[model samples]
Target: DVKVTQSSRYLVKRTGEKVFLECVQDMDHENMFWYRQDPGLGLRLIYFSYDVKMKEKGDIPEGYSVSREKKERFSLILESASTNQTSMYLCASSSSGTGGSATNEKLFFGSGTQLSVL
Candidate 1:
């Protein structure tokens, strides 16, 4: 089974502090993504990388950044944490192939990290 593991299931930090969230996938998938899920706004993509050392900014990248130094690892960074940045962060991976196991490929998700900024 494809597994995505997150470094932390929960995190707490104070405002103005820097925070990091790490994620690793075991399937050797080529695409990895970081998303912040909010109650009414839904899942908002923060960053994604299709290849090693290559990354693209998502819809909400203002307070977030991502690093993909290796094929199976992706990291999310919060430069200066704030109370408003508290949210559920999710990491997901998908195969690079056009179709994986079926006509449409499905994304495998990690358990998610709940970050609280005080």
Candidate 2:
């Protein structure tokens, strides 16, 4: 099975500390994304990388950034944590091609990281 593993399942942070969350995929997918999910706001993308050392800012990139130095790994950075940033952080990976399995072509998600900023 294609698996995406997140660096954390839960986190507690102070108001202004920097935070780092890592994600890795075993399938070597070409697309990696970071999103924050809120109760009613749904998922908002923070950043995405299609290749090593390359990144594209999604709709909501403010106060957050990303890095992908290797094909199988991606990292999200919260420049300064705040209470508003407290939410469920999700990492997703999508293969470059649809291939044979339509269901598997969609994004595969990690368990997620819940961040609580105090």
Candidate 3:
């Protein structure tokens, strides 16, 4: 079975501290994504990588960045944490489908990291 593990399930940080959210997938998936879930905003994509050292900016990438140095590991970096950035951070991985399209791929999500910024 495919498993996605997040380093932290709950976290609290100061407003200006740098936060690192780590994720690792057991399966050799080619795509990894970072998403933040808010009360009314739903799941907003922050960053995604299709391959190692390759990253694509998603909908809300202003305050975030990602690193995929290995096939099974993806890290989300919050350069300067802010109050508004506090939310549930989720890491997901999916294997590329027939044409490398994600439309039909099954996503495996981590338990999630609930970050509280003060």
Give a tens-digit lDDT track for model 3, residues 52-101.
99999999999888889999999999999999998999999998888867
Model 3 bad stretches (over 4 Å): 99-104
Candidate 2's TM-score? 0.93
User: Candidate 2, residues 1-118: lDDT per residue as tens digits?
Assistant: 8899999999999999999999999998999999999999999999998889999999999999898989999999999998999999999999877667766558999999999999
Candidate 1 per-residue lDDT, tens place, 65-113, comes to 8899999999999999999999999999998666345543578999999
Task: Report how far off residue 106 is in candidate 2 (Å).
Answer: 0.9
lDDT on C-alpha atoms for all candidate structures? 0.94, 0.93, 0.94
Question: What TM-score, over all chains together, does every model reach?
Answer: 0.94, 0.93, 0.94
Question: What would the TM-score be for candidate 1 when compared with the true structure?
Answer: 0.94
Candidate 3 or 2, higher TM-score: 3
Q: Flag regions of model 1 displaced more than 4 Å.
A: 99-104
Q: For candidate 3, what is the TM-score?
A: 0.94
Error of 2 at 90 (Å): 0.2
Clash tally, candidates in order: 0, 0, 0
